[model samples]
Target: MHELAIADSIVQIADRHANGRRVTKVQLKVGHLRQVVPSALAFSFELVAQGTSVEGAELEMEEVPVTGSCRGCGVESRLKEFPLQCRACGSDDLRVLEGEELFVESLEMEEV
Candidate 1:
């Protein structure tokens, strides 16, 4: 699954930032459009974390909803399904505001 790749990236980031410190927790911000499975990501994290400072580290994820701004009426809409359209103007011309992000927000670490 792609979660394995994502988890590997996360581990690499945490390890780089940890600077030889033991990672305690990783605060992750995942967007809805990423389509990432939490269970799979958690499992992958644990597996990728082995033999690293991030081993045994807790993974906390925050979900970000898909938000788009309609260019027709200049209105913002929270799109939940396909065929993303503006709620107010019913326009399909929209620009994404958020919900495509996947990044490590913060890392809690202890001195090794």
Candidate 2:
């Protein structure tokens, strides 16, 4: 699953930034389009991070919804998927304003 690779990347980054410190938590911002299962990701993180600096660290995910704005009708709508369209005018002249994001927001650490 993509979540496995994503979790590995997160653990690597956390390991680097941890600098020998024990990681307590990692906060990630995941968009709706990612379709990442938080529980599964957490499980993967535990597997990938085992014996690493971030072992036993908590995975905290913040879900970000996809939002689109229509240039034709100046309307905004939340997109459940891709190919955003204006709800008001049924126009395809829509611009994505949010979503499609995957980033680590912050990390909590404790002294080793």
What's the TM-score of each model vs. the native? 0.93, 0.87
Model 1 lDDT on a 0 to 1 scale: 0.95
Error of model 1, residue 48, in angstroms: 0.4
**Candidate 1: tens digits of C-alpha lDDT, residues 54-90:** 9999999999988999989999999778778899989
For candidate 1, the 10 contiguous residues with the lowest summed lDDT are: 77-86
Kindly report which residue pairs in candidate 2 clash with one another: none
Error of 1 at 77 (Å): 0.6
lDDT of 2 by residue, 14-67 (tens): 999999999999999998878899888989999999999999998999999988
**Global fold similarity of model 2 (TM-score):** 0.87
lDDT of 1 at 104: 100
